[model samples]
Target: MFRVDIREMLVEAQPQMIITNDNLNARVDAQVYLKVRADEDNVKASVYNVANYKLQIVNLARTTLRNIIGTLTLKSANSERGRINEELRHTLLSETASWGIEILRTELKEIDPPEDVQITMNKVVKAENEKVAAVDFATATETQADGQRRAEIKKAEGTKQARILEAEGQALAIQLVNEAAEKYFIGNAQVLRKLEAVERALVQNAKVVIPADTQLINVIGELAGVAPIPLVPKAAASPPDRK
Candidate 1:
């Protein structure tokens, strides 16, 4: 009885230097999963159609990867990894159709560029990040300035409104005083004028003299709502007593 292991196997394509379509060299590695068909006819073919199928598959994988990589630039090889993996598996499946092997899946492990290329790519990424940060900072500054401007405008508007209200209140108070004076002091303007003169004299501490024949006493009596006193004339000395 002969024994053949009809199970899935894993193969690692060792990292090797390959020239890309753009003449740039890169180190590439991959992994492939494959299995032998379990049917009797295909099982026989797995043993007889190819000797040492594992080693043959490895060599085939290397050659296929070189060909595929040769067709792509280094940048494309790094960016379009999924496309490369799919293409590798499809090619393997087609080449091994008669070998009773199934190409299950393939994965690219690494696609490393040269040192100088790597440095250039890193610098590019850093520059892009810095540009984005600068733009964000400028936008934030502009927003803050706009907010301050609006706040100042609001403050100024509030001050203007307050001033307007105060002026209106003062004008209303003056109008009310004038109205009260007009209602109460219709024919009493002379009385008010005399009162004002007295007030100014009192404030200045001035000495004031009133003539005996003036109606000042009567005016004062009227303002105070008091009866006027009658001034009696003295008879001429009783004619010297008619001695």
Candidate 2:
């Protein structure tokens, strides 16, 4: 009895140089999992429809990679690895359909640029990280400065309000004192003014002339708590002259 091996198989595409859409040379590799369907018609097709199918698969994988990756830049190929693997599997499945081959899964392994290109990319990534860090630091610093400025403004406003309240309080106190003085000491203020004038005149040793009937004498006597004495009339001299 003739037997055909109809089992799942692993095919690893070796690393190969490819030119990307941006004209950069990169080495790429991948792995494809496949199996031949075990039905009678698929078995016959797998036996008769293709010769040395493994080699055909390897070459097809290589050519398919070139066709797929050629449309992408090196950066895109590196970033979209899953997409590349899916596309590769789909293409292989369509091309090997007549051979009764079933594509199970595919995985893109690596896409490596030149050593100098890798170095440059690393440096670019480092610079980008540093730039982001610097922007964050500047934003944090500006935010802190803004907070401090707002706090200072609030503090100054509070101090100004406190001073304004204090000044208003002082003005109110002065108004209250003036109202009390006007209510209770209205006449006393005039009396005190005259008293102050007299005191200044006396202190300067100035001589002051005053008539006997002047009210100043009564004012001095009242301040000293003394009553004035009334004079008695002389009636006896007129009676002696008449006799």
Clashes of each: 0, 0
Q: What is the lDDT of residue 240 in candidate 1?
A: 57
In candidate 1, how many Å is residue 236 off?
Answer: 21
lDDT of 2 at 46: 81
lDDT of each: 0.85, 0.84
The alpha-carbon lDDT assigned to residue 150 of candidate 2 equals 100
In candidate 2, the residue pairs with backbone N, CA or C atoms under 3 Å apart (3 or more residues apart, or in different chains) clash, namely none
Q: Report the Cα lDDT for candidate 2.
A: 0.84
Q: Quick one: best lDDT, which candidate?
A: 1
* Tens-digit lDDT track of model 2 for 1-243: 547778899988888999999998999998888888999898888878999777788889999999999999999999999899889989999999899779899888889998998999999999999999999999999999999999999999999999999999999988985775575447667644554476577789997543353344555456558765444667775455664
- What's the residue-level lDDT of 41 in candidate 1? 87
List TM-scores for all candidates, in order.
0.74, 0.76
Evaluate residue 167 in candidate 1 and report its C-alpha lDDT on the 0 to 100 scale: 100
